[model samples]
Target: MIALGVWQLQRKGEKEALLALYERNRAMSSLATYPELPPVPDELLFRKSSVVCLDPVRWDPRSGTDVKGRSGFRMIADCRTGAEGPGVLVDVGISDDFTPPAWTGGIVQGTVVPGPEQPTLVERLTGRAVAARPMLVADQPVAGLRQSAIPSGADVPNNHLAYAVQWFLFALAALTIYIFAVRRRLRQ
Candidate 1:
């Protein structure tokens, strides 16, 4: 219980920091320069951009499901750049029923970067040589919408105080019961 209480307090602090960071990033102006991209650490995950095509290919086939729910294929496309520079990984969300063409065109709006195992999610799927797309490219999303993979869950759920109180109350009740039982035994 004590540990839970401490954890709850820590969670509160983290949630506050996350919200503050989000607000600050939301207020700042958007930039297209590479330097500007590195400085905005907070927006690095979701910063939007317009990218042209480099190559169209399949991505993330291992993470597939057959349940009666929404399904799609993960396709990768390199964002076109002015000079010979790094490309962003474009996650193309396709319906499970739909058959993706070998050469399709679209825009993606999420930062594609290297994971622990692979340079990009596409590489994780295809296992060929791949690099990460770290910027959010607004143009050329294969899914016809700007897709962002931000987690929508709340940062904090403050039920620890109540839980601590309940635990204390249970402890007190156990002690009272023990005392009452001893008194009754003595009287008998």
Candidate 2:
């Protein structure tokens, strides 16, 4: 448990560094370059860009919340950009419907955000290197949907310091109990 607490503290430091990177990069002006393919670097997150989605291949409905925290579904679409490399995943919009939105394809301006995690443990073990592509969160919603929440790095949690403190308290309590028990044993 004590080791676990220490590990969590280490993880907290790493998380803080990642958050710092997000804050620094997010503040920069929008990039002059827009990707034709994906696997965008973590450094590019939150920078505005325009994506011209030529063809929307598939739509994925994910349970998500709006900027106001209202419960809904985000319609993420796999787009065929007519580029040579991998296709892009664009978050079309949010809606109460689980069904795919009626949007076909168009140009949209939004921030470059992290994409969904992919390639499960089995895939990793199998050596399937399916890289998770970064997604474009559209600034405007599709005709029948609402704009999705602009994700922030603040959404990630860092409770490691608190966990370390709790572990230290537990160790102290155990030591105190042991000392008292030893004293009673000696008296008896």
Candidate 3:
């Protein structure tokens, strides 16, 4: 139990550091260009970036929240940056229409953010690593839609310290109870 508490403390420190790094990169005013797969820099997450999507393969309408926190549908464009490569997802905007729009493709300016998390069970099933893909949340809404929320690294949960405290409390309670039980046995 004590070891678990210590581990949570370590996790808290790591999460803080990651959030700091994300903020530092996002603070820059310069816009970064899209990189072709060779494993781009991890710092690219949460940074301002622009991508010229040559072709929008498909438009996915997903249930999401807008900038104003209104629950609705958001249009995600699955684009092929060039002739062929890894598809980059761009959250074009929020709309009431659950159906996809007629958007083809263009230069999309947005804040680079971490994409949706993939289920860990998928990686275990396939015996491979399946991580969240990087996505861009547009600074402006496309034609008829409204603005989608631009997320920050601070959005990541940081409750590890609180969890650590809970574990430590449990350990202390167990010890105290055991001591009382020993004293009662001696008296008997």
Candidate 4:
């Protein structure tokens, strides 16, 4: 039990360190300074960036929420680093109304993130899919929508601390029970 408690404490420390690293990366500046799309480093996830859209904007009916907690669908589209290059997926913003916006294509600034799976609950919500692997989250709000809330590592729940305390308590209880058993045996 004591060993288990120690292991949990170590895990707690590791989780805290990982969370700190994520925060550091998110706080870093945009990668948009690059003239061309550079190879995305793993540390660049959630990093802000700007890219030009090469295709028409598509709406992914996947339910999304704004920073204000307003529920809506995400506006996604294909973006390119250059006119002739391949494109990447970019989520522009959240739209409360179902109607598609008049946005054709242009330069957009936002954060980079992994693409979320299509929402399973609403089958009709699924629209034309883009081929971009890692998706970009636009920083600006869409014409008739609000800015999509960017995910933060701080949102990740780290329950390791609570788990460590539970393990320590169990260890203490076991030790006390053993002491009482020894005392009873000696009395007998």
- Model number with the top TM-score: 3
User: Candidate 1's residue-wise lDDT over 38-66, tens digit each?
Assistant: 22344443333445555554343223222
Candidate order (lDDT): 3, 2, 4, 1
Cα TM-score of candidate 1? 0.44
lDDT score, candidate 2, position 34: 68
Please estimate how well model 4 matches the true structure, expressed as its whole-model Cα lDDT. Answer: 0.72
lDDT of 2: 0.82
Question: How would you encode candidate 4's per-residue C-alpha lDDT over 62-176 as one tens digit per residue?
Answer: 6789878888887776555466765667777888776667777778887777666433545545664432256777788768778888877676678987888898899889899
Quote each prediction's TM-score.
Answer: 0.44, 0.78, 0.86, 0.62
Candidate 3, 17: how far from true, in Å? Answer: 1.5
Clashing residue pairs in candidate 3 (N, C-alpha, C atoms within 3 angstroms): none
TM-score of 4: 0.62
Best by lDDT: 3
Number of clashing residue pairs, candidate 2: 0
Per-model lDDT: 0.44, 0.82, 0.82, 0.72
